[model samples]
Target chain A: MIEIILGKYNYWIYIALMMIGFYAMIAKENLVKKILGMNIFQTGVILLYVSISKVSGGTVPIIWDKGGPYDNPLPHVLMLTAIVVSVSTTAVALALIVRIYKSYGTIEDDQIVVINSHDGDKEIPSEKASTII
Target chain B: MIELLDILLLLFLVICAVAAISMRDLLSSTIVLGSYSLFMAVVWTRLNAVDVAFTEASVGAGITTMLMLAALSRTKRFEFLYRKKGQQEDPNKETNPLLKNWKRKRFSVTKVSGLIVVLLTGAILIYGTMDMPDFGDPNSPSYTHVATMYIERGQPEVNVPNLVTAVLASYRGYDTLGETIVIFTAGIGVILMLRKRKKT
Candidate 1:
């Protein structure tokens, strides 16, 4: 039990973080809150991947003249790309949110849907109407 | 011990995430989320992931927060109340002013369905982690795979001391180019969406 507690506690903490983000992503009403939850979730996954590359006595992936063990480099390479991709996704999502606010006058998902149906029932712009459908 | 520090940092991360989600004020939530990213970077550093830590600190903590605050400034400032205020609907709208969207009542099955989806995801994640090798086992499959090859061979071939840089910029050069293109496309998409066109 002590070994389990001491050795694998990192995974447990990360999993907890992941679950928290999951709950927030599902339940949060605000679109901005959903984005925050997404950042948390991405960080958790990044942490997990980085943790998988850890070596007990190994140093960083930088090779020195002294021959020794090193932490895994493959996961680092992969996660570097993932971290950048996360930011790009966030940027596009936020841009979409801004556009939604401009057209519908609200960022809430439910309200946007309400307006879309209401707008459809009433007179819809010829081009914008097809785009909505 | 390192374990204790790790525990404290992870605890703080969890607190930040929960607080960010629960805050009704969008700006405050964005700030807390930034701090959460900062904590995540620290934890990555402790795990000896220098490159990952650096990226998370810069992109996650820095750029992500700026973009979120920008979006917050553009959108409705506060959360719209969703729960049915049947009996205790506040008469004075001046006290807690909300945008006009608060009038849209939605109690569809979406919330319950969302709960079910998240619970299933959590269960699958927990089960998946059970078979993963214990923390930092040198004999784990990950350390024995392409990582070893990169450390042993890629360094001398590319003349880069850092195996990560060598593999990322050389061995996986094509993949890096693809990622760059993806980021470029995203920037273009954002600019297209946010720019205001002048009516002549």
Candidate 2:
């Protein structure tokens, strides 16, 4: 039983990470914190796909002087794309946060609402928002 | 056995998930979530998917946490929980920001809608999985028809061991090009979101 469990430890870890990321994203109140949670969540999915591709006793993809078959390389390339996408999402999220801060003078969702409700400013379009930025 | 260990690890994952969701402090939850991602990286390694494992370690554990922290920095740390006794003292105090419409608050249509969405997604996923081959079965149709060629001829075509990459980037180069385009679009989105607009 122990041997069997050991064999699949990686999958367990993947599932655990996914749950934690999901929980954080759902539970967090802070916008920044939520973004952090989202990051974890996305990463969890990436890890899951990578783990699923691994094979035992596999060698690196590089063909060495020994001339032997090695592990697959497909996951690596796909992951590269995923990393880039995650970074882009992060950049956009941070920018949104900055804009929110500038307009409301606070980052809290509740506070922003209170401020906006009090202020006479209507829903500013993206065009107007960027102009102020 | 490996199976037992897998079960235990799965259990640990479940516990961490529960803690992450139930925890009161959102910041701590986010950090815990990061830990979860790191552990997942280890899982990927054990599965023998080295490439996937590496990406997970870097992107999942590294990039995601960074983004969450960035977003969190700009928002409130806590949800204001309402106290029953305090509300009686000041009727004007709107403790529940969501209490705008008594009817909506009494029966959260949004929550109901979210549940419906979750259920529909779950049903679709379950249905899709029914047609999928069992994990790691070499005899599956997926292996026999499409994957076999790549496994057999991949070395000569691309000089790469990882058939997955060969199929993704080289054979289906068009798809890869599309992915590049998608990334470019995402980058553009980030730029647009962050760009400073000129004053009138």
Candidate 3:
């Protein structure tokens, strides 16, 4: 147990981060916070992958000249794509948040759902008001 | 694989993540998340994954935070609590049941459900980690697999000097091409979603 805990402390730290992001995504009412939580969660996973590729006596993946125990370049290549995709995803999520705000005047998930629930009972005025606002 | 410096870096990372999540001000949290990415990038560099570190610094710290701030500029920065009595998404929808039931708030279903899900996930992840070869284990599956060949015969198979660049462009050319298309689609999606239309 002690060896598992101490020898693999890196995994535990990353797990803590992943849990933090997960909790925020679930518990936060603000839409922006949720987006940021997603970012945090992605970064934790990225770090986990990068850590797995490390070699104790290795140098960087660049092999321009000399040779040694270079770290696995596969995860690094894969995570480059992951990191870029993460950014693009964030841009899209933010765009959606903006649109949601324009339609509902607030981005809180609960409040938006409530507005939709009452829209049926009072339909026309809500439509007109949403456009006017 | 573990060092005192690495331990300190991870410590700072956890602290930043905790601060980013716990803060009520969304803007502050966003910037704190930026710093978390920065530190994580540094750690990746220390792990000899410079290419990953490069993208993390540029995309994670730079573009992600900029996008967050842009969104924040157009929205409220503080969290909305259920206890706030009169504030509503639509004033026209005055007869909302949630408003009437505010004082009688039975429980937050999302929070409880999320906690249950996250706990299960974290437990599974921890268990998964137990089976993974220890950090810097030379004979690990990842190293023993094609990575050995990549290190041994990389120079011969691909003319590119940088192994990461060679593998990314040559070995996984098709995957990277698909990713480029995905990014282009995302760019178009953003423009369509956020671009203001000329008023009719």
Candidate 4:
């Protein structure tokens, strides 16, 4: 039991980190908070991948005169790409959020739904509707 | 890995993650998120992934925070709680006395259900981790594959000391090109969504 705990503590912590992000994404109503949760979740995955590449006594994957085992470079290269992709996703998601705010005048998911449900009935007055859309 | 430093960093990360999500002010939450990304970069460095650390520092902490702040500037900063219809109409007026009492005690269905779902998923993920190889074990399946070949001959063939660069640019050049295209497409999409049209 001790060996298992010691060996896998990092995995457990990463999982916990991921769950925090997951909770935020699901429970938070604000669109920006959801986006922040998505960012945290992506970072958690990246942390897990990078953690997997560590060789116990290895140094960085740069060739030097000192002969020693080097950490796996594959995961590092992969995560580098993943990080860039995450940034790109954030940019696009934020743009969508901005547009949603412009159209709905609110970024809350529930409020947006309320606005949509009232769309067909034209129950909302013209003055408020003009500001909304 | 430096075990003590690793534990400290992970603890800090968890705190940052919780604080970032729980803060009512969006701007402050974004700043905390930036610090979380910075700490993440430090953790990556401790794990011997320098290239990834650099990318996280620049792209994660720098660019992502800037984008979020820009979005916040365009929108409201504070997250508002769901207001009752009666409350929205008049600040002091109560439509129904019983309804006001019921609203005060009402719980959010979304919050409760979301917590249940998140906990279930987390439990499953923790169960899956039992079969995973121990951290930093050189004999793990990941190192037994092409990683060995890449590390041994990568420097000699590509004449680059950094094996990450050699693999990313030479061994996987097409993959990098595809990623570049993805970023380009994202940039174009953002521009299209945000640009204002001239009045005709």
Every candidate's DockQ is: 0.61, 0.26, 0.60, 0.56
> Which candidate's lDDT is highest?
4
Give the per-residue lDDT of model 1 (tens digit) for A7-71: 76777777877877877777766777788888788878887888889988889889897778999
**DockQ (0 to 1) for model 3:** 0.60
In model 1, how large is the Cα lDDT of residue A42? 80
Score every model by TM-score: 0.88, 0.65, 0.88, 0.88
Candidate 1: interface RMSD equals 2.5
Report the C-alpha displacement of residue B100, candidate 4, in angstroms. 14
Model 2 lDDT on a 0 to 1 scale: 0.57
Question: What is the Å distance of residue A17 in model 2 from its true position?
Answer: 8.7
Query: lDDT, candidate 1, residue B187?
Result: 97
lDDT of each: 0.81, 0.57, 0.82, 0.87
What is candidate 4's CAPRI-style docking category based on DockQ? Answer: medium
Question: Lowest summed lDDT over 10 consecutive residues: which window, candidate 2 chain A?
Answer: A3-12
TM-score of 4: 0.88
Clashing pairs in 3: none
Please state the CAPRI-style docking class of candidate 2.
Answer: acceptable
Per-residue CA lDDT of model 4 for B144-199, tens digit only, reads 79999998899889999999999999999878998899899999999999999989
| lDDT score at residue A129, model 3, on the 0-100 scale | 77
* DockQ result, candidate 2: 0.26
- Cα distance off (Å), candidate 4, residue B140: 0.1
